[model samples]
Target: MGQVIYKERKNTNSTKWDDCLEKFGKEDLLPLWVADMDFEAPACVKEALQKYLDQGVFGYYKHSDGYEQAFMNWEASHHQYQVEKDWIRFAPGVVPAINWLLHILTNEGDPVLIMPPVYYPFKDALVNNHRTIVECPLIRRDTGYVMDYEGFEKSIVEQGVKLFVLCSPHNPVGRVWKEEELRKVMDICKKHQVYVISDEIHQDLEMSGYHHIPTATVGDYDEILVTLTAATKTFNLAACQNSIVIIPDAKLRERYDEYLTRIRISGGNSFGYIAVQSAYEEGAEWLKELLGIIEGNYRYLRETLEKELPKVWISNLEGTYLMWIDLGAYVRPEDMEKVVRDDCGLAVDYGAWFGSGENETFIRVNLATRRENIELAAERLIKAIK
Candidate 1:
């Protein structure tokens, strides 16, 4: 595989670049806010898409047996999780699948639990659908964030929490959860009979020296667990809108299928199917190179920020391309926007957006861009802070 160069995405209808002004209110800011990468999709994915386009038929499509096989093979080979073909189901995106799960699994006003400093959508899925959100914030340690196993179980029992959304290889603060940690969580949720939706969307983007363990692989909690994953985040095919939901329990699968039927979400797009199949089947080498670039970017940002802006502390990035930084010492929560946006001219995901509350001086930066972009952003931040 050859080296993949970063492409210019400013005028390419990219939400991360093209819509920065509309989203962040800054037209000239360097965007490191969105989760999507600036890198192009793998050559195999592009080739498959082009082949489909050349056919010139935009009619309805169906997933072939090869699609399911590709997904199953990828899970087994990459993550060491043996997923059966029958367990696989389709959805346009992980967030949408989450929303659907919210509707089907829990009742209105029932408490749904999430760990904060978590992916914001977990909260939104509950609030938007009128479900009560039970927050069990992860304990922040000097090493990194860890699951509050005691607090987590207590909340589920005390709040009568029916569902839990687990962000494996957690977002913002990147912590690829250990097997012991996941086992404890499974044990707790099992004792409480709480259903878990493990969102492993960032599973494939693990940094060096860390192995991402699938939640279901921890133990036999199939009756109470569902894993949501996608290639879009891994392969930069978010626009293709493809994700996989794996349910091992027959009863749970039936319930979810019934709900999809009720909502009339029977099938996914043709391109999504093709892209997912192509990515899983032929994009491994490209993924390896991408992970190395992301790890390099993370190291660059960490070194640059620590040396120049000593007050700012960057969390250890174990997984995902999002780097969580604490700028509390140098900037106040109330003035973070002005400093980062106006002074630094850098658009980043403010900590508060990820449910950090008033202690909003943390920022999540995207490290999935070119090295030059990373260097430029660091220089601007260091200069601004000084």
Candidate 2:
């Protein structure tokens, strides 16, 4: 394994750093917002991109058989789930795929259910497409967040939810849902005949002592489940805009393909195709190293906050680099930004954005930066809250 190094992204048009001032209205703040990492992409991805550039021909391109094989092989090798190539469909990104599903699968005024304090985009996709937003917020326990099984089922039946979007290894409050948990969800949806779309972009970033279960690989969900994932999040290749949608049922695949055709998203870009293939085939070691850094950062932040700010509660990091911390004890909900940004000079995702009225005092911190930045951010937070 090679040593992981961090670089300065301040002037490089990075959304996480360079665009922070404009987005957050705070200049010179340490940005731990957004999900992308400050670390460089895996060597394999960069080398592959360079190779494509060297070809000197950037014409419209089509993915070869090998392109799809890389994804199939990666899933089987890393996740222990085997998927056929024909079941795979290319999406430029995950969020776009969600919007497409909204247009193709459901109609205006139809109800779509999502676990709240989950990914914010799930709600946006539903509302932006003129569908009803059904919220079944996850239950917060001492252990971490879990599904409200009774409430979830009740909402589905009561609201007449046509589609359910699941965030496995759920975001904001990380919890790599166990196999049993996933099975229960699948069984419930199967009973209710509610279609599901699993957003598994964070599947490969699980911590040690935990495993992520692919929603499609669970019990009896072939017809009702569709999965959306991407190497962009896994390997920090988001700028390339590549993601995969796996639909196993033939009729569902036909409908999805027709939507893609209608929207003129016929094929993938050249750079994204090459980058994903290289990442899936040769980036395993890089991923392992990256996860180690993220875990180390999580531990550092958790311990530092516990010792320095006793009343603040930091959620467990089961998966993903995002840290969800409750700052209610130290600052009022309305003053969260003032303390974290204006006072501490730190830019983080305010909890209010995840859900309008809940967890307003919580803030999400990105833990994929160098150790020094994490330490500095912790120090500033301690000072600000005091």
Candidate 3:
């Protein structure tokens, strides 16, 4: 309903902007990479943080019941998933939780399963923990990306996969998985007695005409399911370093809690708790506005590129502010950096990073920015390709 006021993030130690040279080997390129938005955080989050700042007593803090209730209320209202307070866990971010869960649920050499062309961090979490990475690549179609259910099951069977990291409303590919698909995959995992950790950080950023379904509600696999999410992604509070880890089974929670205790990590900072609680309590309308902006940016980028580059294929953005585009028709994998970065002067997430080499020709663009930024990106992309 209200207009989103865009903010400049060029020199504020922003990862998506100021670190482009370090990350993409380029400087001053129009950055359309990374998942963080180019807008200021919701009013409620900022106001809450300011209120905390106004109180100069910055000491050791503990999470209040109100903090947990806010998240529980958000889950119930937003996704229709009723979460109990005891089922929740705390993490500074989802990636760390993934790594922690990997260590908690599986052995060092145990094989972990993941769909390729997914969130790159899933691979990092698996490999960094000395786990065998098992790849079951998602099958890409005209409509969008879909699961290879048969391949998934076969990989789980052959590799003896004990942990499966799922990206619901998958990153880079931008496919908000349907209920039936979730059921099928969970059923397979249930059959194999595999533990699943669904990275749902992007759970709240669905585009118009789309709804995000929390994977925990899909089936009776709570004993083996761990849902990781964060208000940081939804409310642009990533710097707050706070995330929610929901484990329905008491035994699994106990195991995760033991790992946390062993590592001497208890919870996040006071700012993270205050910001997240405020966001879940009063940021609904702000989110509604942000989603509309993302959808508009996606439509503009798609129409501009599709009209100019006939072979360019932009995947339908069902959820998240990320867009996956195939520039293979115009550029080869070997020249992706040259065409996209050197020639077009744009910093983007290379598709190869999301997978091995199957997606070498694709590029993932972040659409959670000003419309003018998207327009500039479109113009640069079309010019470089043509």
List RMSD in Å for every model shown: 1.0, 1.0, 1.0
Model 1: per-residue Cα lDDT over 199-221, one tens digit each: 99999999999999999998999
What local distance difference test score does each model get? 0.91, 0.90, 0.91
Clashing pairs in 2: none
Query: Which clashing pairs does model 3 show?
Result: none
| Structure candidate 1, residue pairs in collision | none
lDDT of 3 by residue, 1-386 (tens): 36466999999999999998899887999998888999998888888989889988999998789999999999999999999999999999999899899889999999999999988989998889999999999998996889999999999998899989999889988898999999999999998899999999999989878899999898889888999999999999999999999998999999998999999999889999999999999999999899989998999899989888978987899999999999988898999999999998999999999996659999999998999999999988888888
Candidate 2 residue-wise lDDT, 1-386, digit = tens:
36456888998989999887798987788999999998888888889889889989998897778789999999999999899988999899999999998887889999999988988988888878999999989888875888899998899999998999999889989999999889998899999988999999999999999899898887879888899999999888899999999999999999999998888888779899999999899989889999999999999999999998999888889999999999888799889878888988998999998986658999999999999999999999998788
Model 2 worst lDDT run, 10 consecutive residues:
1-10
- Displacement of residue 336 (Cα, Å) in model 2 is 0.5
The TM-scores of all predictions, comma-separated, are 0.98, 0.98, 0.98
Worst 10 residues of 1 by lDDT: 1-10
The number of clashing residue pairs in model 1 is: 0
lDDT of 1: 0.91
